[model samples]
Every structure is written in structure tokens, then in C-alpha cells.
Target: MTDDKSKRDFRDRNRVAGDEEYEVGYFASKFGLSIPQVRELIARHGNDREALEREAKALGVR
Candidate 1:
């Protein structure tokens, strides 16, 4: 089955663990933060996927 838009939305917003698609450096650069900082945020807060996109809209990650 195909992933729904909601799932895609969630993944885009999330910075979830177990996601090996992204390297630490990649996340850092995109978020404009240090690698450790990105790691810490993801570790502590985990990810919502959709929330991240919203956050990006607010913070302008794109």
C-alpha cells in the first residue's frame, strides 16, 4: 500500500530516530544547527514529522 499524505507529512516534519536516510551533518546543515545539537533535539524530543514541517515554516528551514 502507498503511504498516505498524512504519513508523508509526518515524516517530513519528524526528526525521528532509526531514520538512517539522513546523516548527522545533513540534519545540522538543514536546521542550521550543530550536528550534536540536532542529535540532542531529535534524541530528546524525538520527532513528529508533520511538526517539523510546521516548524520549518515558522523557522524557515527551507
Candidate 2:
């Protein structure tokens, strides 16, 4: 059987999929940022959850 852990872990928690609007919206809401801002952060910083959270806080979003 294929290893589903990678896919499941990613979708459930950890990295945010940049192409997924729902994930973006979730992060945006969590950070109190606009969707576009979250998208921009993802573009610039990639989709690592901890990194994004740190960056968001740095951006004064938290």
C-alpha cells in the first residue's frame, strides 16, 4: 500500500497548500490577515506552517 502518512499529515496539519483556497483562508483567518496577504506570505516564504506563523506575527498580524 502507498504510504498515506505524508499526504494525510500535510492535509491535516503542518504545511499549507498554496493552491488550496481553503487552506489559505484558514491561515488568513488564524492570522487575522487578508487572503491576499496570506497568499503573498506563502509565495515569499513557502507553505511551512511554523514559518508562516512566525512571519505573520512579524508582520504584526498576530
The number of the candidate with the highest TM-score is 2
lDDT of 1 at 2: 31
After the best TM-score superposition of candidate 2, give how far the Cα of residue 30 lies from its true spot, in angstroms.
0.6
Task: Write one digit per residue (lDDT tens) for candidate 2, span 31-62.
Answer: 78999999999999988999999999999734
**Model 2: residues with Cα > 4 Å off, grouped in runs:** 1-12
User: All predictions: root-mean-square deviation over Cα?
Assistant: 7.0, 4.8
Q: Which 10 successive residues of model 2 have the least lDDT summed? A: 1-10
What local distance difference test score does each model get? 0.53, 0.83
Writing each residue's lDDT as its tens digit, candidate 1 over 23-51 gives 55666577676656656556654665455
Write down the lDDT that model 2 would get: 0.83
Clashes of 1: 4
